[model samples]
Target: MLNHIIGRLSLGGLLARAVSAAALLGAFGGAASAVTVPILVADVDSGRVIYSQAPTDPWFPASITKLMTTYVALDLVRQGRASMDTLITISPNAAAEPPSKMGFKPGTQLTLGNALKIIMVKSANDVAFAIGESLGGSIDNFAAMMNDSARRIGMRDSRWTNANGLPDPQQWTSARDMAILARALIRDFPDDHDLFSISAIQFGGAVIPNHNGLLGRYPGTDGMKTGFICSGGFNVVATATRGGRRIVAIVMGQPSARERDVKTADLFDYGFAQDGGNGPGLDALPGSSSAAPPDMRPYVCGGKKVPAIDEGPGAVSASATTAAQLVGGAAASSPSLALAAFSSPGMRARTLPPRAPLQPVAVWIGRSPAEGQQILAQQAAEAQAAAANVRAARLEAAKARREAVLAKRQAVQAAAKEAAAQKQAAKAAAKASGGVPRSASAYTSSESASMPEAKPGKGLTKAKDAAKPAAHKPVAAKPVAKPVAAKPAPKPAKKAAAKSDE
Candidate 1:
């Protein structure tokens, strides 16, 4: 039956050795005597517990707090209270947190979606703090909301003190409770579940590889988270799917990362075996071991350190004990120092009223100072020439504009005068022909005019005949004058020739 169960598990991926409870104890060696390492595996589809060893035992949550932070932020997006693209600014307090951070400067902004990616991939503590401050106004307020969400999700043994699980004894959760949270996260945020399965995330030039080993090694593994601290050792809540069967496993307090993977693989094998109807094979082992109790010594005593809570803007300083005295002391001391610091930067001398003018120092030279003044005169002359050129260019442009205007005016006057002369000549011709002058007639001349005594049809014919003769009359007159002048010129030349011959 055990072989059949192991075979069923091997159908999805190769089967590895199932380390017995005794082997688990030996692997822990002496460490198991002092710590309670709780391990739980469940069929996520049915929420049925397949195997359990101290499933309800509480342990430090470490950086696992980011999972809850992401859950709450995604909830806000789901509820329409915020959007994934909403920009979040890094506050001064967020910027001041230690690294394993996105390292955004105080005023740098990132979209809510990218910020969540940094928290999941980089485990960026500063981004978590900024998200808390942006969403709930403070980390404490955000943690309170986280606890509220835990209660809503039936995470009875979980409490969150900070967004990024940096250490707090007060901050703790059980394997069973973390499994419940993981289930809730997967069920509520199915779209973003792929973010957890990512093996590495690169932002800017920094590459943060996911700490969860199951993403790479486990064939069907898709999502969940990994966490660690000095006290918590290492913990992982892993989920895997095979042939439509999904399971969630929470392993806490594994001595080393290798043991954690081995134990998780064993849990998967056992889970696959049971679901495949393999008969129970490990009945000889005790149901519960008489292992030494968990060492709560680190958290129980006064050695547990309470983290400093950031006081937001306008918050009264935690060290301000006496309100009136503090206010009075600050008011009294601030102005004098401010004045002293202000006055020390040569400002006091600058602010003083002007002093009486000082007398000029005279120096004797071998030559008069006027000897050196020639270069200055030459520079002045060159400057004057440049100024004159600039003025000339301006004057030329102005002259061009004036000339264009005058030319346009002259064209208008010439057209008007030509129209007037044409009109007067048309009027005189109409009077001679005994016809009323018309506006159209102003454009006609005597050559276009017809005689009133002529027949209406033949009037144009007679006008053309009259115009032909008038055109030839100028040539006829030139010939007649030439003959008259020729006759007189021969008489004068003959008289002059006779006188010259005598």
Candidate 2:
């Protein structure tokens, strides 16, 4: 009964529902089922495949295409044709790429290291194009170099049509082929693999988080690429280390981000377990599954279509509407309509029509004084408003500061006046007491004067009281001397004395 239930559901069907449930619930806890999606897990140290399923089955690579771009770049560095610090200039073509891009304006410059970081973190399409243009002078020429490099590196079943993999039906790759490329990158540029391990990259006030979830979630997972497109689904080439063994796992056609990560986690768990003691050794795993027979079945969705991958200079013409405007307008109506349109063969063909010729607009130069005057007046009004705001702020600040300063000054002056009054009262009291005002010059000096020394029996009552015992011991009571009368005036006093004698 269990076998019947398991056999009733295809691996693809089970995965679709599992991915849906995981996305909604944020976890997966159902019965374990074998993952039938094409994958390749290999040991990076020995260039050995540990486990693989449909490793050679062809599938769209999406932005995983950037791995080849990096491979080509590193090859240039290895050949001494370029340095890792070289600066690449953004061109108009590069600036025109859709987002999930570093929206660097044309003529903007970034170092090779920064460009690679943008590619690894943001998966920036513009940076990829700029690198290609800088390296090969054009993306077309750069793609040729990429394919040649791939062939040289023994990626026998791989092809590249663009530097930043925007959807082209022709941009197909195999899991085994991607694993081979990943091995080359690690082996040839061990120094730069850290670029892939970066979790977040900041540029131009925009901080792009890496799409590869393994960087933070998986213990030993380090470097590689993740990719997605409507047709390609989600894919990743992930590297992890456990014990002394390093392995790379490639998963393609995952239904969603969570599924992709969970599936990758399972692969890592299995690979590590095998490394510990369970399964076959790395070398014993199948070397190369058969290459997918060429996709000879003609595309039947649209009227008999040419198989030529759209390789022209431009695939889509700039409409009267910008990409954002078109997408927004479509989304406002049906929400899911835009996505549905992209999936429809007819809409894709129409929307991505061949590039149109550049149309020139007539230029009218020279303005009348009145027109110029009007513009000047508008600018002057704006400037006046700004200046007025600045003046108002300055005035408010100055007023507050002035009030504070005034309060501080008033407090200081009141303190000074109080001190002066106290000093004046002290001087007046000393003068009233008939004491020779002790050291009047010292009192007037800014330095506070010490109290004068008290004389014996002088005005310091506290000292006098304290010295009462001493006061009694002092026996010098000098008699008060009255002024002597004049010899008396003369005769009157003499006559009085003669009478008394008779």
Top candidate on TM-score is 2
Query: For residues 407-491, could you state the per-residue lDDT of candidate 1 as single tens digits?
Result: 9999999999999999999999888975643542322232222322334244445445544535555553443333222122234
The window of 10 residues in a row where model 2 has the poorest summed lDDT is 20-29
Tell me the TM-score of model 2. 0.51
lDDT of each: 0.59, 0.61
lDDT of 2 at 145: 99
**lDDT tens digits, residue span 281-355, model 2:** 333444444343222212111233422221111122211222224345443332123222222323222322222
Off by over 4 Å in 2: 1-36, 276-502
Error of 2 at 100 (Å): 1.2
* TM-score against native, each model: 0.50, 0.51
Instruction: Give me the runs in candidate 1 sitting further than 4 Å from their true place.
Output: 1-34, 276-502
The per-prediction CA RMSD against the true structure, in angstroms, equals 32.1, 26.0
- Tell me the TM-score of model 1: 0.50
Which pairs of residues have clashing backbones in candidate 2? none
